[model samples]
Target chain A: MKHTLAVLVENRYGVLSRVASLFARRGYNIDSLAVGVTEDPTISRMTIVVRGDDLVLEQVTKQLNKLIDVIRVTDLGSEDTVERELALIKVNADVNNRSEIMQIADIFRAKIIDVASKSMVIEVTGDENKIRAIEQLLKPFGIKEMARTGKIALRRGPKSV
Target chain B: MKNINVYEKYDQQSDRMTGRTEKMTGARAIIECLYREGVDTIFGYPGGQVLPIYDALYDSKIRHVLVRHEQSAAHAADGYARATGKVGVCLATSGPGATNLVTGIATANMDSIPIVALTGQVPLSMIGNDAFQEANITGITLPITKHNYLLQDANDIPRVMKEAFHIASTGRPGPVLIDIPKDLTTELIDFHYPETVKLRSYNPTYEGNIQQIKKAAEEILRSYKPVIYAGGGVISANASEYLRALAEKVQAPVTTTLTGMGAFPVDHPLFLGMLGMHGTKYANYSIQESDLIIAVGARFDDRVTGKIRSFATNAKIIHIDVDPAEISKNVRVDIPIVGNARKVLEDLLKYVDKAPTDDWLQRIAHWKRSYPMHYIGGKDNIKPQYIIEQIHEACKDAIIVTEVGQHQMWAAQYFRFSEPRTFISSGGLGTMGFGFPASIGVKVARPDKVVFDISGDGSFQMSSQELATVVQENIPVIIAIFNNGYLGMVRQWQELFFDKRYSYTCIRNSVDFVKLAEAYGALGLRVTQPSEVRPAIEQAIASGRPTLIDFWVECEENVSPMVPAGAAINEILDLERKA
Candidate 1:
């Protein structure tokens, strides 16, 4: 099972390496990981997509709690959460196919960040499924370039993630 | 770009502990607590950042034993904890010294020995700046330690310190590191010690689950060929009675891990010699062929289990351990009853029916008769194995600690330990420099108990700097070095697998061990003949203070009944012994 754990940690230099090392030593894999600062300057939240069974994730969470820098871990898959991922897809779209791609992007409420004669950069933000759907639509147009920020999550209602 | 708040622990008007307010620095408060905790002796080394703590120590009544290396402090602390049940304390400066303590801390962790390690950190402002002599000691030690604390503020000292000792000594028992920023130790604050720790996340289940206990009981009662595989947990949990009861009730044989040696009396019929590499042949075979393996507090380490795939392949495995990380981490357990080993065993014994198994007992007896743990170096010449056995005979009740490599294994193999905690070695971490300091810790813990450190020449050199600490403290510990002049384990590997291309295994500049001991204001004995073994050991033990005995033995000797790397436990190699 893939678990998306959004963790808040102190911005220590080797904090990421410690987390990665823990996963590596424990024989677990990180599917995707993204780290960015939150409102609190000292605290940087990391969104990590890890592959493990429920039991493995529970053990991993317990071990991570032992790390001084890691404050808390939230498994978004098991909770009612708002998940977002950003991707800049440079599509190989000529003038003719650019209109079709723009129309598809408009349906998903994705923004056209950049446009050139040979390619158009489509910026999309959504949950994993929505992002995958958008990427599939742009695949036929020949993806020339791409960059993705892995899933970032926040719990719903009056609660802190 | 951002406003920096003056980082401070909440200075409540009433104080953390109600009704008392006394001004003191974190350094002073910690020293006061240590004094209150009855720590008369400390093993440590001074440094630039920890100078304030040393300054406080001078004013305090405690006697500090300065070691040549910081790593020695940690090992001494570990040895002390094992010797005495109290928390062993050691202190070191920031950065490299803290990193040097890693081997000792990990050694303590692997053996489940309780230790309190103190490290100085850079000033709070320069923590992440990578300032001079600043390393993330807390971060470096996180994975190996049970718990660690970074003291950023002065006010939280007493509470943090008291809890550090508490957590290190409680539950499964392991090492805890406390990294103190130099500035905080010097900063004055109102001292307040919280009576209780309000850690919501740490709710350790000490008594254990009744249902799982019942399941363990059911499994034990149903099995015909039962074998009890024990480890350091028995000693850590103080569950000797529980172990005896379970063994007596079922008529099962008990074989312990290398660290678990003294948990059960070696003379007991149910007690099989220590299992795994160089273990009793029958013990390993019995555990591998048993119908049910009741592994109490023993993590199926690679050395003990050999290849995990075929480790007790046909048997039903019921594992009981306090640490949750142990469960399913290596070999999957059919029944993982997680809790304190003593409590869980006691709880399981409650549900067990009084059914005696004469069949299992008979089979174990047969196996023992067929393949016993024995080696006859039939030659009359002095050998390391003979000296270890002679020393064992001399100090039957004494606590024996060992450094890593061949001698450690030889001591484990030859020393017939019949008392609990009598044999202490760095089993898991295999730290080469473990013995002398550990002996110091042991001697400090039990002043009345005789302590002997079985050291290999190569391994002893790593931390022998503690010779100064031993002399300074005036604690008597006999260090018997099996002087093979080679890193015996590595030498064996080189001879067998690497076609005898000896590299760094040889000790190029051999020190006269007798002169070495004399230099440290201790007695030294050099034994070259078999007749000299017993006399030298007796004289050294009788000499009072620290003593070292150098026994010149054959270097080509190999540890037998070893399961080579990545091999199954049953596939053991019995190396040919010299006739």
Candidate 2:
């Protein structure tokens, strides 16, 4: 099972390395990890996606909580949460496929961020499934380049997580 | 407020708050902070990067023991901490010096020993440039240390030092590191050491949850066959008395981990000795067949829980530990109580009404009588087990330390440690060179007690250079080397599973340890006969100088009652031994 953990840690130097090193040392693989400054500048929020069984996930959460720099850890997978992944897809598009790509992008509510003579960049922001859907559709048009910011999540309600 | 209360306990540092600030170098600030923290001694090796700190120590009253290697410095500090229940301090310079301390720091971290390691770094401006003797030690030690810091400013010295001590000594105590650049040591600042720490997110839970405790109590009350499996945390929390009381109240058999050797009196009737891979046959059997297991301060490690699914299959486990993460990390539990071992044990004692477990006790007694730890006594050569037994008889109350290998397990089995902090060894990391240097720290901490390092010919050679430090510092510690002419543990494994393919396990006794000791100005004794063991030990103690006793024991003697790796602890592989 894949588990998403929302970890809030002190904004201190080497904290990221500490966390990354922990996973590496323990032989736990990180599927995806995205970190940024939280509402409190002194704290950083890291959305980490890891694949493991219940016991392994529990161990991951507990180990993260043990770090002194870490403030709190939440298993967002168990909470009512909204998750999103942003992707930028640059596809080789001509006049014929350009209009078709625009239509497909419009259906997905994606934006044509940049347009060039031979390629067009499509920016898509949605959950993993939605992003994957758009990426698949763009694949037929030949995706020249692509970039993705791994899943970041937020609880559904107003409650702080 | 919590931080204030914690620091106030060390009030000596809190009272000297003269409103005036005095200008001093960062190196002086480090020394001053240590003094205020009641640190009178340090273990370290000096180098160019740490020259500033050493210079500050030249005129100061703090006593610094110069170690031969940076690794020994960390181990010595760890031994000092375990012996005195105080945060140990180790210092080293940059690059190789800092890297050498990695193994020792990891060893301390694995066992949760309270230690503060200070290392020198290149100048702040030269940090990323990879200047001479520069290493990102804080980054290198990030995973091993509980917390680490790189000195960014000289003004942060006092706060960093104070916090380092606080973090190292508090909440499931573990090693912390602070890497100071050479420039920071020379930079001057107005020093005013912080009185308290205010890290809001760093508070640790000390009291177990009431509902969880209640559930654990119900399980304990309903148990027919109960056992108390204790670990190093009991000793760390100074809760051995509480653990003993709880065991007595429940009439439960007590088994300990390697690090938990002295957490319960070995001679007690209810004690089942150690339980795990190298544990006693009876204790492992009892754990496998128990109805309830009250795990105190022990993380059910792979060694303790072989084939985790089959471990304690019929038992309901109640795990009590200071670190909540340790619970269910390796093995699932019925009830988890997160708190200090001493406090949690006291809480459990409230509900531990006297219970009748005659049937369980009788079953365990049968196992004990039938499968006791025994060895063959031969007239031709000295047996390692016989030497351990003699040491037990001669110095029953002495502080015994061990380097990791066959000798460690033999010592654990043959010797009886009746008090906490008596048996100190490298349980988690199993580092080979720990015992010798660690004994020096132990002797320094407990000057009134006799200290001995039971070592192997293979393990002792790793840190034998420490004899120079021991002789120079005038710290008298006895070293008992079990000369089997092989890396005995790996050899045992090879003999059992790999069809006697010894490979590199056989080590030539090329180094004359007796001459090695004499060269370092220490007493050296060699004993090849069984009758000579006790006399040599007695003579070493009487000499009152650093002494090394080289005992030539029978080669290829394997530690028995072993559990094949990945098999359940209950399915122990036994070899024929004369009882």
Candidate 3:
């Protein structure tokens, strides 16, 4: 099973290496990883997705907690989390297919950011599945380029990630 | 709040319990602090000025295991550290003794294993005088250590000892040292151990960047042909599961660096074993062909990157590590994810999609079939490969340690391990005396696991005296010596690189190893025939005592797939044929 975990840690030198080193030493497989500042510049939040047996995932989360810089770790799967991803997809659009492409974009509430005579870039934001679903709809129009930010999740309500 | 406590028992201690009739010196304070810290053992030796530590050690509870050489102590400590997560301790006296420990310290530094080394200096005044048995031990080990202290002040003894242990065991974890002046050992100080450390220069980070995590996720979703180049970092970060999810989600194949052996299970389809000098051809090729190389916790050692400029030419590299120095030190990276691998990986996993890569898997499978790690050790009488296989079978995932020689190479080529800290050979140092003491250290660290010392005749004799330690400690390690009766690897060097005028290579008559083992109260076996190898290993494992199987291998046998020392990774001498 795949589990995506959100982590908040102190921004300091060698902190990332230590965490990566812990994963490497412990034999954890990180599929895709992204890190950046949250609301505060001193702290950074990381969203990690891993695939493993339930026991191994539990062990990984437990071990991650021991690092000094790691302030919080949460598996957003069981939480009421607001997950979002952004994809800038460029597809070839002609006068005949422009209306159809715009119609699908309208359905997902995606925005048209850039448009050339031959191609139009559509920016979409949602969960992973929603982004994939939107990308699938635009493929028939001859997809020219695609760029996606994997996934980032924040717990909804009084709690924040 | 400059408060200090000396052996403070929360309960109560009558100050008059053990009135010190004798004076306490800086040297005695070191031993006293170590005893208070509950240190049970130290792998070290005594010489010159450090005789003070040894003398004080006699009255101490800590048992010191004297290594024949100082370097072995460092390696032993490293082995102990890897097996157990605690910081390993080692001690060596001044000058030559201190100089000898350099290799082991560097090894610990390179591998990021935590070790605390104590070395003696001549005296504070004589430091720059180059007095008898005086060398700048602190200056020499400065670069390799996480931090080091020159305890010219007698009052700093307890505090330095406490801080060294703390620094060594915490954060990125590597070796630390405390060098005491011989004169200071005689100087008196009010003994007090500092509980906390306040160092403005130190302190490691652990968190990941939320934006970077989002950016990486974006890359993964957009990348059509991505590959996760996992390193020892996965093991270090304790992030194997996170790495796996990220790979599986995007349908990315994974390859590991040499240090990354057990980060992922070897049998996993994603695992491409040990990609570096003498690495699998498929593994090396995969890194070269990868579109997006997600390097977890590994440094692109020169051995791993054939031609640094040409490495992963078309790939966008995602370099993740804890050491900031390591980030831009080697390869140029497109995404520099600076945080714990598990944390960074955890955040990135949120946005990755679980999808299958049919085309990439097919292409990789073809590469695997095309370039496999080959050993032409034929199905002849007693092949080295067969011998290694039988040893592995006899000692199922035992803590197998090796001395540096051709046998070390053979063992690496043959032994199948499933985890890190199981294969405890001196990978970076390749020290000769490494095996016996390292085996002891590993055994000490993991008492439940069976440990074995795999040595060649040349390597075993380095610290063969430690057999006494085995008999005394009742450690039942299997010492399988591939006795080619010569300094095997160098002889091969003489044969290949130099004209085979074998000088100082032949071991015409060494001490009878059978009697040697018997003398140490260990079981001994001399396996001559090919058929006897398996039974010998079986009997040795079952003996429940330290056993040495001196296998009289073909005298001229050589290690194949040799990478010329300090040469390009791809340059190998494929010479297995006997002339």
What candidate 2 gets wrong by more than 4 Å, as runs, is A94-97, B1-20, B576-579
**lDDT by residue for model 1 over B1-579, one digit each (tens)?**
111221122223223534476787778777876865677778888999999999877756566777888888899888878766778899999998899899889988888888889899999999899899999987788678887888877887888787887788887788989999999988998876666775543556578788877887888888887889999888888887889888887778899998888888888998888787667788888878888898988988888988888888888988888876677778878888878988888888888864456877888889888877666663655677788888878878888899988888888877878777788888888888889888887887788988999998888888777777788778899998988788889988888789999878888348888898889888888987788889988998888979989888876778877878888788888875675
Q: After superposition, how far is residue B477 of candidate 1 from its true place, in Å?
A: 0.8
> Scored by CA lDDT, what does every candidate get?
0.82, 0.90, 0.76
In model 1, the number of clashes is: 3
Per-prediction DockQ comes to 0.25, 0.84, 0.01
Tens-place lDDT per residue, model 2, B1-579, is 134553344344334544457788899889888887888789999999999999887766677999999999999999999898899999999999999999999999999999999999998989899798888888888888999999999999999899999999888899999999999999999989778997877888889888888889888887899999999999999999999999888888999999999999999999999998889999999999999999998989888889998999888889999998888877888899999999988888887676678899999999999999888886878888899888888878999999999999989988988999999999989999999988888999998998999999999999999999999999999999999899999989998899989989988677898999999999999998888988998898888889999999888787877888999998997753442
Q: How well is each residue in A22-117 modelled by candidate 2, as lDDT tens digits?
A: 899889989999999998999999999999998889889888888888999999998999999999999999887899999999999999999988
Q: Which stretches of candidate 3 lie over 4 Å from their true place?
A: A1-161, B1-29, B35-38, B59-61, B125-132, B186-188, B240-251, B377-380, B485-512, B554-579
lDDT of 1 by residue, A1-161 (tens): 89889888877556787788788777888888899888988788999988888778887887776554678777788888887889888998887888999999999999998888999999999988888998898898899888998888888899877
TM-score of each: 0.88, 0.95, 0.69
- RMSD (Cα, Å) of model 3: 18.4
Backbone steric clashes in candidate 2, count: 0
Clashes of each: 3, 0, 77
TM-score-wise, the better of 1 and 2 is 2
